[model samples]
Target: MPAFTDIMSDAFDYFRAYALRALCKARAMPRGRIKHLQLVVGRIYNLLKKEAAYAPNTQQLQDFRAAQQLEAALDRRRDDGSAPERGFAAARPGAEREAR
Candidate 1:
């Protein structure tokens, strides 16, 4: 069997490739859709943050950091006007009601 570190490295590499592909696809999507994708990534990052807090393992921490970076990138994209005009609130449910 492969060593643990080797397996982890391979998995991380695969994850990077998959994320890149998804990002490329997202670039072609409409601004509203990108906002939704950003929201989804943000949620994933938050979940990873919680998980890392509970487990406190190296791998978990690394994954949490990666998610955090991705979330930041998405936020930057949104802020730069590449995502939406109405801002993040537009992507959340009941945002219109909340805004009123």
Candidate 2:
């Protein structure tokens, strides 16, 4: 059988949801641990995108309301489901060196 390229199952949705929950709660974790959890959440995001399992309005990175208070503790708090702005300009190619 061909490997499943796309699927929208309750299990996958639950995993994605809980993973975001975990990420929201990971603010209190150690730096390394938080990074690891973020990595896992990122992978889930990529896989879900590959599956095209997301609906029109649902956010992939946070709970429905996205009112998690732990965000207040972050120096770079992000409320949207978009990628966490971990570092400015780091994602852009040669951005750091270009500034010099």
Candidate 3:
């Protein structure tokens, strides 16, 4: 099973992408305004991380540091073509038929 944090991260990322798509396609928002909204949302998300970062025991501290390092490494690897590109990707045309 995935960790709760992993699930929540996926959920938030999906929602962010959905919102951006809606803003671009339906609302025709400007890119500058979209970027500003992303920044603000990111700042608010960081507050949640901050609130959970205090009072960690030695083991928890180690795990937290390791997770941070792993995330950074994965992000750096993102440009190496190891990660699949997801932008604008969508389900196949026949997916609905398959589901039915």
Candidate 4:
């Protein structure tokens, strides 16, 4: 299987989009929503990766490996779909996930 980073990032994108839609509705946006979003995405990715890697080998692990492999293969496509804002410039704490 491929590195965990690709797999986690793709999964995060799917869930993050859904979450953004649900929480984005408001005349005045909640404070730090974007930052909070980033943290949630990171946490989900780490949790999934940990569950897949640390647990004993099993059918679930096999499934995880396959999904991660597919994610790596489609990384370019996935990244293009999830490109960050053009004008957003800042090294936010915990914004970037650690490479596995």
Instruction: Give the candidate number with the greatest lDDT.
Output: 1
- lDDT digits (tens) for residues 1-100 of candidate 2: 5556454556466556655665665644545534564545545544554443545335633532232223332324334424543445465888788778
Candidate 1 vs 3: which has more TM-score:
1
Give TM-scores for every candidate, taking all chains together and pairing residue i with residue i.
0.39, 0.28, 0.29, 0.26
Q: What is the lDDT of residue 98 in candidate 3?
A: 69
Error (Å) of candidate 4 at residue 38 is 1.0
What candidate 4 gets wrong by more than 4 Å, as runs, is 1-31, 55-100
lDDT of all predictions, in order shown?
Answer: 0.58, 0.48, 0.44, 0.45
Q: Which portions of model 1 show Cα errors greater than 4 Å? A: 1-31, 49-54, 83-100
Over all chains combined, what TM-score does candidate 4 have?
A: 0.26
Question: Candidate 3: which stretches are off by over 4 Å?
Answer: 1-54, 86-100
Q: Ten consecutive residues with minimal summed lDDT in candidate 2?
A: 64-73
lDDT of 1 by residue, 6-93 (tens): 5344444444454555555556656675656755654554454455434445675577567657767866786697634564556677
Winner on lDDT between 2 and 3 is 2
Write candidate 3's Cα lDDT for 43-88 as tens digits: 4334334433443234534544454454345435543746454444
Give the lDDT ranking, best first: 1, 2, 4, 3
Give all candidate RMSDs, comma-separated.
Answer: 11.6, 13.7, 14.9, 17.4
